[model samples]
Target: METVLGIDLPTWWFLLIGALISGYGILDGFDLGAGAIQLFFRKEESRRIALNAIGPVWDGNEVWLVIGAGSLFAAFPLVYGTILSVFYLPFILFLVAIIFRAISIEFRSKEKMKWWRQLWDISFCVSSIVISLLLGLILGNLIQGIPLNAKHEFIGRLRDFFNPYALLVAITVLSLFMMHGAMYLIMKTEDRIFARLTVMANNTSKFFILCFMATSMATLIYVPHMTDIFKSHPELFILPIAAVLIVLNIRRSIEKRQYRRGFVSSSITTALLLILFAMGLYPNLVLSNADPQGNISIYEAASSTGSLKTMLLIAFIGMPLVATYTVFMFWTFRGKVKLEEHSY
Candidate 1:
């Protein structure tokens, strides 16, 4: 195997892509989660505060998703095409949801009419839920294995994306997002709204814990392949152990009224969970059930070694710039949101 900087090109790109996704999940996940439970804030002021809390950074956060998808396409065109083609319908819905979520955020404060604001609030909440569910569905299918033909294409029926297990994963993801969002609200609020959000945060945390436990049990009992790495290399078990502790820390931090710490814990938990997923799928970018031999390994699906080397150079230069921008933006927008005449 040809190596660049002590690692194979394909493996390096895989790690690169995964890191981008982890960035997306941590950055965008809370905003989506905040929107998922928007209707819970009955007062107009409460809703405004919630919306403003994420307003400044929500759009910037989605850049990670765009970058992750583009990186996947650039690094492994075959895997990109095959997976997108497999779940085309959900992708279409996810795209629409993203557009509408942005629209709702912008248009909600454009008018003072009750009906107008109410309409956009519903739009924002539902679209956020849809985006989260669709992401989980795609990830679930990847974990459960897809029906891919010998030609490296999806051969499953359109409805295959809605399998029972996939739906369960959807529940898990939505619940987790809601919890993450609540923590963000708690961190960015004060007064009665702060009190209100703390209660919601605690409730959503329990909801997420339930969904996550069920999802984990289902994966262990039904999706045995996902755990194979842990079985073969006992050291891999540390990922799950770390994820569990982080989840507990989220609850403990919230109980201690440490909102920033709780949010950090949630972010770390998100990264650990994705790392676990990557560990399970390493080497194989997409698995095939229709034809057992049709699996698209990283090496098989990746572009030429020369192309990957070039991409590695671009990624090394580009990602740090992106990270710096994200950090600067968040630091600039830090603190509780205050609604003003210019505020959205």
Candidate 2:
């Protein structure tokens, strides 16, 4: 169905889901990345400080994930069900990681036993890494597309999920998150830790930048006709070009020791990457080399027009409030985490 603005309801629904996922990546990506790196914070006090840096904001950051999922269920139930069913094990593992991390975070502080706290710390770090990898895998699967039956249901065994292109995509995303998280650590912490984090950020960002470019080129080469989208629509190349410029800026910012600016630049690069991805796959939500017509387009997977319209209205009204609250929470908690000597 069409909207008052002249666009179809399904278009808006797709836009909503895209925005939610992008927002989640930009917000929670750092927190999860930080948690992953916390494993290396060998000193118990250092680990505690790292945890404190994200403590107040992490829960709020996760809201974007909830919003993204809710938007998918409400606006594009078909896509949601297909994805969940197709990657059932990965999704389950992701959920388990999130749950364990949350539990460990809360319980870690309450436990006075050194071994107990260490166990909790390990759980938090390991879970973060798992969740981040699973997220990347999910995106990889989408890019590679799943095996769909005549009924449009995914009908492949678990082994089908493993492919060169998908694996590359997963590695690229994992590296991106690691860099993003390191940049955040540089921005949020101070003293020697911050300096160390800055060095880590620089190294990881360079490595990931190379990996991203390499994987992107390889994806185009390995996946026959994968570059067709860019070739047919040359305008789409601008997104990646802009992404490269942003990455350059991130490097310069880091070199200058402008941690905040570096973080922002990295985020912009991430945004550009997401935008390019969305544009590259436009019209088709999922694409498969095996079955050309099995492609699931946004139009085919969206909810009913009336339902989409109603949800759009509600989202328009509520999304700003959510954004406001999120920003306020971050602002309230803005500061470097101090060592125990400075603790209240």
Candidate 3:
């Protein structure tokens, strides 16, 4: 098949899938994080306020996840097959967490009984935490490179999921989500709930900074050739520098009780992380140290040129509409959530 505009179809698909997943992480990360932190509130009214704050937008945020998975299944079947088959356990756990959390969010508000609400709250919090950790672990595994055989299939055992580097990455993601959640709470709630969230943001931000540093150090030591990328591409250092600056700004914003500034800083921090991830997606999607020649470049993994052109046309028409609706929904729901109502 002739290449379209000199670019292969598979490469375009990979880029699309990557963008979708990353976007989902940035948007939904805060909501999940907020749900995880919901455990700290003792007052039923405060909990209601927290839940209501995210109620309108949480389900919409999940749309990006569905888009990402769908794109992978339709466009990059090989990558999807490998990931789903190899990471079966984590995948199942992630789905279960998402399901339970959704149920908890919907049911908690209907019940007037204290015990029933508490049970759902616990489910929501725990599920959020687990999902966030699993996402981190998946990223870690990808960067570390799964054990692929001659057929480019994963030969890794279940125990490999608990490796030290993977665990550190999971911690880093968990901390980041907590920080993101605190920022969302700062923006969505007011009065005593907002004040409490401010304190929570300050503490969580510090914890995340520590985890980020530890994860970076561990990745440097464990992932071979990763340091070389930094050394060779000195320009990439700007991303981490910007991330650090944003972290400091978040701290400053919290100190001044500027919720808007804090939220913006958190968003900037998330952007910086995404940039750093992009920096690592060089030469190939899955790098193999065992067989250097086995690296799966975007060009090699792509579909036919005709298929890519058609997909691009569809994306051009559909993506903008999706973005418009998402923005409109958030704008309509903008403002502080009150505790008087019990709906999520």
Q: Which residue runs does candidate 2 get wrong by more than 4 Å?
A: 224-226, 339-344
lDDT of each: 0.91, 0.79, 0.80
* Root-mean-square deviation of every model: 1.0, 2.0, 2.1
lDDT of 3 by residue, 91-205 (tens): 9999999999999999987878889999999999999999999998988877887777657766667998788888888888888889889988888888898889888998998
**Candidate of highest lDDT:** 1
Q: Over the full model, what C-alpha lDDT does candidate 1 score relative to the true structure?
A: 0.91
Q: What is the per-residue lDDT of model 2 for residues 182-207, given as tens digits with 9 covering 90 to 100?
A: 88877678777776787788887888
How accurate locally is residue 129 in candidate 3, as Cα lDDT from 0 to 100?
A: 96
- Across 1-344, the per-residue lDDT of candidate 1 in tens digits comes to 78987998899999999999999999999999999999999999999999999999999999999999999999999988887788888999999999999999999989999999999999999999999999999888888888987887667798887898888988888888899999998888899999998998899898888888998999999888889998889987988999999999988998898988998999998899889888988889998868978799999989988888888899999999999999999999998888898887
Candidate number of the best TM-score:
1
Residue 45, candidate 1: alpha-carbon lDDT: 91
Look at candidate 3 and tell me the lDDT of residue 241. 79
User: How does residue 129 of candidate 2 score in lDDT?
Assistant: 83
Return the clash pairs for model 3, or none.
10-302, 10-303
Winner of 1 and 2 under TM-score: 1
State the weakest 10-residue window (summed lDDT) of model 3: 287-296
- Sorted by lDDT (best first), the order is 1, 3, 2
